[model samples]
Target chain A: MNIIVCIKQVPDTTKVKIDPETNTLVREGVESIINPFDIYALEEAIRLKEKIGGNVTVLTMGPPQAAEVLREAIAMGADDVYLLSDKAFAGADTLATSYTLSKGIEKVGQFDLIICGKQTMDGDTAQVGPEIAQKLGIPVVTYVSKIEDIENGQIKLKRMVEDGYEVIETETPLLMTVIKEINEPRVPSLRGIMKAKKIEIPIWDASDIGAEGEKIGLSGSPTQVVRIFAPEVSKEGEILEGEPTEIAEKLILKLKKGKVI
Target chain B: MSIKIDLSKCTGCKLCVKACIYSAIDVVEKKAYINNNCTLCGACVSACKYEAISISKKKKTAFDEGDYEGVWVFAEQKQGKLAGVASELLGEGRRLADELGVKLSAILLGEKINGLGKELIFYGADKVYIVDSPILKDRLDETHADVLVQLIREHKPEIFLAGATSFGRSLIPRVAATLETGLTADCTGLAIDKENKFLLQTRPAFGGNIMATIICPNKRPQMATVRPKVMKRAQRDDTRSGEIIEETILNPISSRVKLLGFIEELSDKVNLEEAEIIVAGGRGLGKADNFKLIHEMASILGAAVGASRAAVDAEWISYAHQVGQTGKTVCPKLYIACGISGAVQHLAGMQTSDYIVAINKDPDAPIFDVANYGIVGDLFEIIPVITTKLKEINGG
Candidate 1:
C-alpha cells in the first residue's frame, strides 16, 4: 500500500462563526473547506487504496487555491495530486509547514503510509503531524483512531489517548495522524468526478519542492506572530430566565452557595 | 521576518482585510495581498493604517542569545502520576524563572518516578530534571524526543514549557523538531519579553477567534505548550527547596514504534483533563439518545462528560467526548454547559472553566458568554431538575 494523503485547505473553522455583532470573527460566508479532519485522511487513504493494491498519493501546501484541496482529494479516491504552490510558500509555521511537507514528501517517491489530519481546521496545531514525522525520520502514529492490521511491513495501529486506546506497532516509512474515528469518508463518484476533471494537476513550486529559501517561509517560521487580539468574553453573564423547575432550583442554589456543586 | 505590503502605501482600505484573523488578508484588485493563510501572525501588521504593513524581522541566528539559561518544565508523568499540566507548568515556570533571572527547572520523565522530585519540588521547582528510565517505557515520541532532546542540548533552557497534553502534544513537536528550536502550541499566554528577554507566546487562532502573541526571536530554547487549565497550580511547598538533577540517558535510537497495549475507554470515568466537574453536551443535546441526560448530570455531579464539536460532530459523543478547540483544552472546576452553543470553538475549551455553568435553551446562547452560571432552560426541562437535585444531595 503506497498511501500518502496530507491534505489541508481550512478556513471553515466549523464555519468560522462568532460575530454576534462585533464580538469578532465572521470571516463572511467563511468557505474554503476540506480540513474537517482531512476528510478522514482522505478516507483512510482511499481505504488503503481499496484494501492493499497501492497508489493513493494526495498532498497539499497551499496558495494556488490550494489546488482546490488537491481536487478534493481526487474526488475521493485519489490517485495522484500534489499542489505545494509558492510565493515562497507564504508564512508557514508548524515548523515551516513541517519543513515544507518534508520536502514535498521527499520529492514524492516511495511511501508506505503517511496520512495526516489529526489537526488543522485553520491550524489547531496538532503540530503538523508530528512535524511531518520529524521531517521524515518517519514513525509518527498520533491520535490515529485505527488501522489495526496491515502486513509484511508491519502497521497495526489504534493510538487515541488521554486515558484510552494505544496499540501501535509501526514500520514501513510510516507517519499516521488520522482521527474522526478513522473512516466514513467516501462520497464522490460520478466516475470520480470524471477522474477529477481529467487529471492534469501538477503544481509544485518553491523550486519544485527543493524548498529552502532559508528553509521555506517567512524566513522559516520559528513561531513569530507578534500580536493579535480579541479575547475578552464576559458578555455579562447571569441569564437565568425562570421555570424549568425554577431555573433548576435557582441554578442549584447558586451552585450550592457558590461552592460550585 | 517578512510581511511587506507597500503597493505605494496600499490604499486597499480593507483594514488589512479586517485585520485578518487568518483569513490571511486579501483585497485583490484593490491591493493588500499576503495569503496562503499567513501565519506571520502580525495580524496584518497591526491592521496597517497607511504605514502599509512592514515587519522585516532582523534575522541572524546561529545560537548565542547568550547561550541560554534555565526555566524548563515538562514534568508530565502518567502511571506514576503528575501531569495536571505538571503543576501548571511549574506555576508558569516560576513566573518565567522570575522573569528570566533564571533557574526554575522541572523535567522528570517517568517510570518509578518516586517522590516525583518531591512532587516537582513541591510545586515551584528550582530544579528537578530526573530521567528515571525504563527506556522511557514506551512513551515514545521518538523516545520522549530523545530524552527531551538530550536534556535540551545539555542544559541550555531559555524557556521550554510543556503540557498541551496528549503527552505534551505528542512530545513537544519532537522536541521542537529535534532542537532546530522554536515551538509554540496551545499556549494561553506566557510572557517575558520586556525588551528582548523573548518568550512571549500567547496563542489561539480561529478557534478562540484569534489571539496570537508568539515569539522565538532566534530560537535557542524558547519552546512552549502551556494550556492545561491555563496555568496556576504552583502553591504546595513542603517548605520550599531545590536541585535533584539525575539523568541517565542512552535509549534514543531503537524506534520503529511498538507499544501494543492500552485500552482504558471503559466509559471513561471522569478525568477529562483532571475534571473537577464538567458536564458538557451540545448541538442542544437533542439527540444521540440525549447522552443519557449528559450521563445523568455526569452521574449526579461527580462530573466529566463533555462534548460539543457540535456533539462531537453529531456522532453525539466520543471524540473523547470533545470539549472545544478541536476537542479538549478543558479547565474544569465546575464547567456544566449542557446544550453547548458557545462555539468560539466551544469557548476555546471550557472558557477556562472555574465555574462556568450554562444550560442553554438559547436565550442568545453563546454559552451565556462564558457562563459563570446561566440557565435559560429545556435541557430536557433542566436536566431532570439538576439530576433531582443531585440525587437529593447524594441520598443525604
Candidate 2:
C-alpha cells in the first residue's frame, strides 16, 4: 500500500500577539511550526505503511522555511517528502488552495490512501482536505476518530459524529481526514534523524505540480481579505465584591434597580 | 438591491427561514424563499440541515470617482473602556478611509462612554456616533442591534466591520438581517477591491483546513465580522483629532431585557485561552480516578488541566476543561496529553497549541506526531517521575 500525508506550516499562536490599537495580529518575528493536526495525518500514514509494507510520502505547500517540517516528517519514517512552493501560490484562499493541492497529488501519481489533518491553525477552515477529495473525485470520511479494521482491500473506520460515532467501511485508495484520536505518532529516533539530514526534499512549482494559472494562487482564490480588525471587548463589568451574604444582597439590589430579577 | 437565493437547493427545511430572528424567510410550496425584506445574515446556511441556502448579489454597482463613502465600526465597549477589538477595527477603518478618502467613523453605544469616544479619535476614527442612555449600559443583544440598525438606516455607511467575538457575533447577524444586507463572519483576511471598492472577505472553511474568500458584492455598506487576534491594531496618536456625533435614542427603557447586577469572574478560574501551559486528560486515562495523575502532572508543569470529550463525558472533568470543536477553542503554549487519543473534535479545540507533549503507552497514538515530545510509556508511571523531577528542580 502507498499512503500520502498532506501537511501545512502555521504560526506559533503563543507568540501571536494582537495589536490592541490596530485590531490585527502581529505576524512578524513569530516562529512557524507544522500545523498540529497535520502531525496526526503524518503519523497515521506512517503506521499504515508499517502495517501494509509500503512507502509513506509527506507533502506540504508553504514558503521555503516549510521544508524544515518535511525533514522532521522524513525523520519519523516517511519514505519521501514533497514541497509545493512558488511565489504565485501566495495568498491563495481555500478554494484555490484545494485546487493546487489536488494537482500536486495528481503529479505524485497513484496512492492507496490520502490522509490529512482536519484543519490548520492560522486558517481554521476544515475545508481543504474534503475539497481536495472532491476535486479528485474520491470519497471522504471526515472527523475519523478510530480505525476499527483494515483488510480485504477495505478499511473500517469509526467516524465521530455530534452524538456518539458511526462505523464506516470504505474501499482502498480512499481519502480519510483524521482527527487527533486515530493513533499516537511515533517519535523520530536518533537514527531516523541522521537519515533525515541526508534526505533531499523535492520542491515542486506550479508547473511541476501541473496546476493551471487560474487554479493555483491568489488569482484563483475567490475570497480576499478586505479588512482585518480585533474584536470589541465590552469592559463595563463591575466587581460585586464583599462578604458572600453582603455581595448577594448588593447583587439583588442592583438586579432590582435594573428590573432584571 | 436584492439578494439572490438559490431556489434549486431549497429543501423546505425552513431552518434558515425559522432561524432568521428578523422573520425574513417564507416557506411557500414547501420551499423556503427569501422575499424583498430578507436580510442576508446567512443564518439560514448555519441553520439549514439540507444545505439549501446561499447568498448571491443582484448586480455590481458601477463606481466613479468618490464612489466609496462612509466608514463604520461596530464598537463594543466594556465598563466605559472600548474593547481592544473595537479599537482594532478603527485602525483598519483609518487605512481604508485614507485609501478611499472617506471619514472613518465608529458607532458607540453604552452608559457613560463619552470618554471612550475620545480614544476612538486617537486610534483613527474621524467621527464617533454615540448612543448613550442608562438603558444602553449593559449589552442587551436585541436592543443594541435595534439601535445599530436604526443608526445605519439614518446615517448610511458604505462599509462596516465588526469583531467576531461573542457580542459582535450575536449583534452583526441581527443588524445585517434587519437591514436586509449581507454579512460574512469569522473572516481572517479583508481587503478593498480597487475596482468597485468591494470589501473582500477571507475566512477559513471546512473546519479550518482551507481559507475561503467571500464578497458582499451587491450589498450596500459591505459588511464583515473578523476574528480577534488575526490582525494588527494601529498606534495611538494623541495629536489626531475627530468629531463626535451624538444621537438621542427616544426608545423607552422598559423593553424585553434589562441589565442585572454584575458578577465578577472568579480570579482562580482557569481561562484556557490565556493559559500558557496545559495538561490534558483523555479516555486513555482508563477511568475517572486516573484524572488525578493528569492534575498532578499539570501541577508539576505549572499548567492548567484540560480534558478531552471522552474525559469530560465520562465525568472525569467538567465541560469547562473540555477542548474540542463543541467545547472551548484554545491555543496554549504547551499542551501535555496524558493517555489522550487525538480525536478530530478534540483536536479542533487545541491543535493550535504551540508545543504538544503526548504521554501514552501506545506508540501509534496520533497525539505523538503533533507533540513536541513523546513518551511511549504509561502516563501514570511517567507523571510521577516528572512531578518528582519538577519538585527537585524547584527545590520544594
Candidate 3:
C-alpha cells in the first residue's frame, strides 16, 4: 500500500505575538517547525508502509523554506517529498487550502491512503480535512486515536468520540486525519538525516497543481478577514479565600448572585 | 440573495437547524423547510450533516433596500444578571457602531428583562431593545433565536456580535444563518473598516497556526462570536444610562421544545475554564508514582492538575487532565509548567494562561518565555519546596 502524508510548517506559537499597532501576527522573528500533529501522521504513515512494504511520500504547502520540513520528513523515513509553494498559494483559507492541496494530490498521482493531522496548529479550524475530503469526494475519518487493522484493501481504526471511541472500518484509498494518540513519532537517525541532505524536494506552484486562481488565497476564499484586535480582558473576580468548605460557601454565594445555580 | 433548501435530501436531522443559531429551519412533516424569513446566510452549510442545505437568493423581493446598518449586541443575562461577556462585546460593538456612525443597540431578550437594558447603555449601548416575555425566562435556543431573528429583521443591524460561550455560540449562528449572513466563530479579535463599515472578524485558525480574518462583505449584519477572556469586559458605570425601547413579540409561536425542569449537572468537575492557578505535569515525571507529587502540590495550592500530551499518552492521568490542542484549551490565571519541554502541540493549549511559572531542569524549555516566573531546576525538587512554602504562608 502506498501512503501520502500531508503536513505544514507552522510558526512556533510560543514566539508568535500580535503587533500591538496593526493587530496582526508578528511573523518576522518567529521560528517555524513542522506541525506537531502532522508528525504523528507522518509516523503512522511510515509505520504502515513498513508493515505493508511500500513507499511513503510526505507533502507540505508553505514558503520556500518549508522544504526544510520535507527534508526532516525524509530523515524520519519518508521515501519522497513534495513542496507546494508559490505566491498564489499564500493567504489561502481552509477552503482555498483544501482546494490547492486537492489539486496537488491529484497532480502527484494515485495512492491507497492519505494521512493528515486532525488539524493544523496555526489555524484551529478543523474544517480543512473534511473540506478536502469533500472537495476530493473521499471519505474522511477524523480524530482517529488508534489504528485497529489494515488488510485486503480495507482499513479499520478507532475514532475518538465525545465520551468514548467508535471503531470504524472503511475501504482503501481513504483519507484519515489522526490525533496525537495514534502513534509516537520517531526521531531521525544519523543515516536517515544524512540521506535527507541529498534528497531533493520537488516544488509545485498553483499552475502545476491545476488549481483555478479564483479559488486560491484571499480572493478565492469566500470569507475575508476585516480586522484583528486583542480581546478585552474584563475581571471582577471574587476570590473565594479560605478552606474548601468556606471557599465553596463563598463560591455558592457568588453563583447564587449570578443565579448560576 | 435568498435562502434555498432541497427538502428531498433533508432528513430533518435538526443538525442544520440546530447548527443555525437563527431558528431558520422549521422541521415540519419530518422535512426541513425555510420561508422568506431567512437572511440567506450560509452558516447552515456547516451545520448540515447530509449536504441537504444550500443558500442563494430568491427570484425577487422587497425589504432589500433597507439600510442594514448599526451594530447590535444581545445583552444576554441569566437569573437577572448580565453575562460579563456581554459587556465585553459592547466595548467591541461600540467601536463598530462608532466607526459606522450608526446606533449601538442592545437587545435584551428575557422575562422581566426591562431594567437590564439600562446597564447595557452604561456599558456603551446607545439604545436598549427589550423583548420581555414569560416564554423567554430561561435561555432556550428555539425561543431565543426566534426573538433575536425578529429583532434583527425589524431593526436592521449592519454588524452583530455575541460572546463565543455555549449560549452565544449556539444562539448567534442560528440567527446569522436565518438572516443569511456570514458568522465567524470564536473570534480572538474584531475591527471596523471605516471605509465600508465592515466588521472584520479575526480568529485563530489551523489550531492557532495562523490568524484568519473573515468578512461578510455583501451580507448585511455581518455576525461574529467572540470568546470570553479573549476580550476585556466593558467598565461598568452605574451613572451612565440609555433609553429603553420595550419590544413585545407581535405573534409568538407556541414552543415545541419544552423546558423540562433544568437539572444543572453537579459533577464536581473542576472548571478548568475559570481556574486561576493550574499546576500541570508531564511524562518526565517518570512514573505514575510521580503524579502524586504534582497532585499534592496542586491540592496544597487549591490548583488544578493538568498533564501534558506525553503524560496523558502514557496513561499516567485521565484525558480530561490532559492539556493540549486535542485535549483542552485553558487560559488559567497562573500556569505552572513542570517537566514539559513546551512542545508546540502541548503549548497551544495553555499558552493563554495569565502568569505562567515554569519549573524544569532545562533552562532552554520554551515554556519559560511565556512564564512570568521561571525556575531552572528539577520539578521533583521545586514542587515539594513550593508546596511546603505555600503551606507555611497559609499556615496549613
Candidate 4:
C-alpha cells in the first residue's frame, strides 16, 4: 500500500489583511503554514501506512521556501519528500499546476493512492486534485470526509455533498481530496522532528520530471486575472443602539416593518 | 511574468519581500527587487505601501466574435428535482442572451428527466436540450464532463453558465480543462459586455476582501460557475412555450468510482440552502455550549441553524451548518446573526439574504454594514427575549 500526499504552504487567511489603497493582499507579516486541510491528508496517509505496511511520500509544488511544508510532513511520519520547484513552474494556475504535479508523480514512479486537501485557502479552487487525477488518467473522489474501509484493492469513502454524505468505492491507484472532518492530525514528536531535520528532500525541476515548457507555467494557464478591486460596500443600514430590551424591541419593529417576521 | 517595482516610491519596508511566497522579491539598500521566480500573483503588489509595484502588460489573444451563438445554462438536477441554482442560472442566462440577441438554451442531463425540460422552458430557456439515460442517474464526474464536452464541441455557445454547486464546481472545471478553455468559479455577478459580447464574470477573491472581474477573450464557450442564491430565479410561466431537443450520447465511458449509498447527518435535517430563515452563531457566543441559544431561537422561528467558520473550526458545530466562502452559500429570507462580528468570508456567504438582522455587543462590527436591522447589545440577553417574543406572537 503505497500512498502519496500532496500539501501546500499557504498564508494564514485569517491574519491576512488587504491594503485599501492598492486593493491587494497584504502578505507581509503574515504567517505561512501548511494549508489547514492538507494536514488531514498527511494524517490520513500516515494512518493508512501504519495500518498496512507501506511507504508514504509527500509532494508539493511551490517556491524553494515551500520545502518547509514538505519537512513538516516528514516530521509527521512521511517516509519521503519531493519538492517540485522551478522558475518555469511560476504563475501556474490549477490546470497547469496539476499538469506539473502529474509529471512529478510520474517521475516518482508507482503509487497505489494519492491524497490532497479538498482545496487551498488562498486558491479556494478544489479543481487541482481532480484535474491531476484526470491528467494521470485515474479516478478521483473529492470532499471525502471519512474512509469507511480499505481492502482487496478497493477503498470505500464517505464523501460530502450539498444535502448529505454519499458512500463511494474506488479501486486503488486512485486520487482523493479530503476535508477537515476526515481525521485529527497528529503533532510531530521531538524524535520525529529530529529525523525530519536530517532527511534530504529531493527537489525536482520541470525538465527533470519530463514536463513540456509550454505546459508548465504562466503560458500554460488558460485563465488570467485581468483586474482586481475592492468590493463595493453596500449602503449602511440603520443601527439601533440601546439596552438589550430596547434594542430587541427596535429590531422586532424593523423586522415587522420589513414584513420579515 | 513579473511586477515592476518603482524605486522612487519604495520605502524599504521590506513588506513585499516578506509577502513573496516564492521568495522572488528581495530588499537591499532601501529598495525591493524582483527575481525570476516571481509568478506575478499580485500578492506583493497589494502589500507594497508606496504603490511601487505594477504587473506587466499581457499580449492579447485574438478571438472571432462572430463564430459563437447561443447562451447556455447547465440545468443540474438531483433525484429528478431541479436544483434552485439551475433556475437561477437560467434567469441570468436569459438576461445575457437577450443582450447578445441569441437564444437562451439549457442542457438537462439525467435519467428519465424529460419532464424537467418543460419546467426549464417555463422558467426562461428558449430551448431545452435533454439527454436522458439510466447511465446518467448518478453523477460521475468523468462521464458528465465527457458528455458536456461532446455537446459543447458540437454546438458552440457563446457563454455557458452553471451553478457553483458541488456538481457544477466539479464538472465544469474538468470540461473546461479538457476543452482547453477558461472558467471563472463562484461568480457573484455575470453580464454580457455589449461592446465585445463577452461574458463579464465577477467573483469575490482573497477571502472576499476584493472582487475580480475575469474574462476569457480568446476562448469560445466562455464558462463560469455562479454561486447559488446570488442571482434571482426565473419566474415560472406555464403559458410560455419553447423547443425541446433530445440528444443521443454514444456508449458512455464507465466510471472508476462507484456510489454505494447516501447517509444524512441526523442532527442537520434542515437543508441550509433551501431554508427560508437561518439563525447563525459566531465566536462571540463565548463557548461551544452557548450554541444552544442559537438552536433555540432557530427552532422557535422554524429556521435552520448556521455557524460561522470560527464556530465550525472550534468544533462547536458541524461543517454542514457552516455558512461562509468555504462553507455553503445561502440566501434565506431572514438571516438572524447572533454574536457574529461578520468577517468578510462569512458576509460573502449570506449577504444576499433578503433581510439581515445582526445582534452583537460591538456597535462597529462589520455585520452592521450589511444588516437591514442591527441591534447593538449583548446577544446573550437579546436572543432569548427575541425568541420569547416570537413565541408569544405565535400564541405559544
TM-score of chain B of each: 0.41, 0.68, 0.72, 0.86
TM-score of each: 0.34, 0.48, 0.55, 0.91
Query: Tens digit of lDDT per residue, candidate 4, span B242-341?
Result: 9999999987777778888988878955578878799999999989999999988888888999999999989898999999866777888899899889
Instruction: Give a tens-digit lDDT track for model 1, residues A128-183.
Output: 88988888887787888888888988888987787678898878878888877777
TM-score of chain A of 3: 0.91
Residues B258-300, model 2: lDDT tens digits: 3323322332234564466788888888898888877775675
- DockQ of every candidate structure: 0.25, 0.02, 0.06, 0.57
Q: Give lDDT tens digits, candidate 3, residues B206-234.
A: 34544456776756677777766666667
Model 3 residue runs over 4 Å out of place are A15-31, A161-166, A171-173, A189-191, A226-261, B1-186, B189-199, B204-214, B218-279, B282-287, B293-304, B309-320, B325-327, B331-348, B351-396
Q: In candidate 4, which residue ranges exceed 4 Å CA deviation? A: A233-237, A243-245, A259-261, B1-32, B43-65, B284-290, B313-316, B343-354, B362-372, B394-396
Superior candidate under TM-score, 3 versus 4: 4
Candidate 2 per-residue C-alpha lDDT over A1-261 given as tens digits, one digit per residue, 9 for 90 to 100: 888889987665434544454333444465667787888888888887777788888888876667889988988888989999886776565656777888888988988889988667656655567567656756566666677678866777765432234556666767777876676778899999999899888999999988888656655554444323332222233443444344435533553354332
RMSD score of candidate 2 (Å):
21.3
Best by DockQ: 4
> Native contacts retained by model 4, as a fraction?
0.58
User: What TM-score is obtained by chain A of candidate 4?
Assistant: 0.94
